[model samples]
Target chain A: MAMIDSTRRSFVTRIGGGAGAMALLTVVPHPASAETIDLPERESAILEAAFGSSVLTPGKISLDMPILAETGLSVPVTFKVDSPMTEADHVTRIMGFAPGNPEPVLADYQIGPRAGLAEVSTRIRLARTGFVYAAAKLSDGTLWGTKFSIIVTLGACVEDIFDLDWQRDAERRAMRAEARAAAAAE
Target chain B: MATIRISIPETAAKDEIVEIRTLISHPMDNGYNVDARGQRIPRHILHTFIVTYNGVEVFHANLHPAQSTNPYMVFHTVAVETGTLEFTWLDDDGSVFSDTRTITVQ
Candidate 1:
């Protein structure tokens, strides 16, 4: 987690009143013990009730986050996996989890042979330090994943009563990414 | 707590990959903020997540405390034979919350 400075607040206020609040839809499921986040344990129960016991293995996933975020409200994030994409070796799903939250369930991506490769990258918010895991389903009808811990000291999405700009920053970031990629290829 | 919802496009053509978007509500405590007592609270978080289609587990990510509460993640998947896509959430207590979305792959 990172701390907020007065300048950042003013920056957000000047922009608008929409801090990627809608973006909350894509979460990374983490554990409560990883940070001060208190979440109901039933989230997983809900998961099991819907999907039966699917085997999840270890050492086949990766999470890219900061050891110490410069700001808690917005952190750069990227997730990737090394799985075969053939019809026989293709992956079916990809899930992201962060432990220390009121609800640990994050974003879930349904992937297949069309995903190009077993790779994905996006921005996410971090509230604390704990283990982050990536779980994937292989064409063999089995589950596999990987996990890592990040230590920090601040909340990422919080702000003053009338603060915004997370969305703008995200948009700016997307453009910059595109520009940089084009520059790199050039 | 916020309800996490997941949905797959019903228009997904058979064998066409569709994008999945999911959101869960949880407070990500980075062990930085202090309460009225100024006590450094302990860590609590989601361990890992697993998504499956028909009966096969597919995608997943390991979450850390540093991730913001109610973290929202987006990923991609393919609709092979037109079946329900089951999305599940796994917690530290070994608990799980899941939902199934029907995919009408043309």
Candidate 2:
């Protein structure tokens, strides 16, 4: 009992002494390890809307993304789909999606017969550290894709640019709106 | 406003795959930040890119706000003959920037 009491007291003291640590928590409290790797709801919906009744297989795509991106401002990504650029069999389009961004669909590329190539490389910004997906549409109406995760240190999608004052104001506005709605309901 | 640059092999063997690279200059505003006076800055970016080889459509892309300033792209294609490659980038402001290069296939 004494040992447990001592441990609890020490934990409290540690928590109280480290406001800087608390600030860090305000950003991403959950470490990357704690964050499960799963397809986000938005991403799943996008895929469903795109493929409709067709099946989306997970192969024939190569996604090149950095494991760790220091800046969310610009991260390079390259996508390649294995296809013969012939008349009957060719890649029609390649689309990029980021589930965590303010907008999920990042970019779309239309591959025509003249391109003769099925690979594309571009730089994209990220809102937060999250998974990036690339999907390729074939002429035969088949869809193939691949996804990879990236860690961003500095975020780019700044709805309020991390201003605490602005955040407080926004929160207050939201609360007032909620209260008004509840009163109206009553 | 933006300028485009493209790189391709000067010569290639028939049916050989050639790499194409391109770059553009522009500020891709994410439309989320406020200016110095705390006013939100409007977003601007190059939204579309299209590549044509010898009057045939080959590669095209639609960009978004997530793209950084001075966008760069690299792609691959097979060489068939000596032809002109036209690269065009459309801006959000309805402006178009274009460049052309010739690839000689031996």
Candidate 3:
């Protein structure tokens, strides 16, 4: 009985190895041939939450930012949307997101016909080297989006200072000041 | 009160597109950093900024911690009439800092 069991186990192992090799052979040829732009899962989820069920058309948005940043503490960004800025047709909102940051949602701008141009410039903090996305919601309920890739030499948002007690330090300074005042009075 | 700087044309033509720039001084602590003793620093940042032209809301922004220190913004608006433009910045501590500028549209 033991000998028959060992034989069956070996047979199953051989079949499994053969199937795995066949699967690898089939998948190794295609190295992502399609040129479709893919967004990270978190970024896609954010877009879905902002504009539910609306198709994100990748056009009409021009995102301008630096390709390389010396520091992640501040990265300048500018985005513009091609719109007439009329009462009937205009951009209603623009949103910026930094997926590499601790909190992805950077800022959201609300505008209307009063906004003569759908352009904005601001500074944002990035945690690391990654893609920054900008989306615009027009009056017609259509969503337009774009993205820019940036590389950061020094990242931000990581706690740098440690082993320093702010409260105790302040207290000690205050005590020293009081002692000085007492000596001056005497 | 925080220091604020606003730059806009003193006068503009009717229906002209005018660029408005604003800068405010704030720490914008993102709460992710730690103190000298390794204690987490509480987050304090300017959360909202709003601009009203002649008492009508023109542009507003919801800011997050990702905004850099001393937030600066530049945007555009149509000069509909001669009126005051009020810019307000709201802080995380429920404090509001505001400034107003007058523009003449001929």
Measured by DockQ, the strongest candidate is 2
lDDT of model 3, residue A65: 63
Indicate whether candidate 2 or candidate 3 has the larger lDDT.
3
- Best-fitting candidate, measured by TM-score? 3
TM per candidate comes to 0.47, 0.74, 0.77
Give per-residue CA lDDT, model 3, range A1-186, as digits (tens). Answer: 111232454465467653442111110111234223345678678767876733456777666666677888887777778899999999998887887777888778999999998888888888888887788899999887766777888877754322145577556656867887899999
Give the worst 10-residue stretch by lDDT in candidate 1 chain B: B32-41
What TM-score would you report for chain A in candidate 3? 0.63
> When superposed on Cα atoms, how far off is each prediction in RMSD?
18.7, 13.8, 17.6
* Per-prediction share of native contacts kept: 0.20, 0.78, 0.93
User: What 10-residue stretch in candidate 3 chain B is worst by lDDT?
Assistant: B32-41
The residue-level lDDT of candidate 3 at B69 comes to 94
> Tens digits of per-residue lDDT for model 1 on A16-94?
4424332111223334344322223553453343234333455455555554555546555555566768777876666
Best by lDDT: 3
Candidate 2 per-residue lDDT over residues A1-186, each given as its tens digit: 111233454465458653432211111112334322245677768757765622446776656565677778887776767787788998888888888787777778888555676878778888888777777788898877666767888877655436436678567657867887899999
- The TM-score obtained for chain B of candidate 1 when compared with the true chain B: 0.85
lDDT measured at residue A153 in model 2 versus the true structure, 0 to 100: 88
A156, model 2: CA deviation in Å? 1.6
Answer with 1 or 2, whichever has the higher TM-score: 2
Each prediction's whole-model lDDT (CA): 0.56, 0.72, 0.78
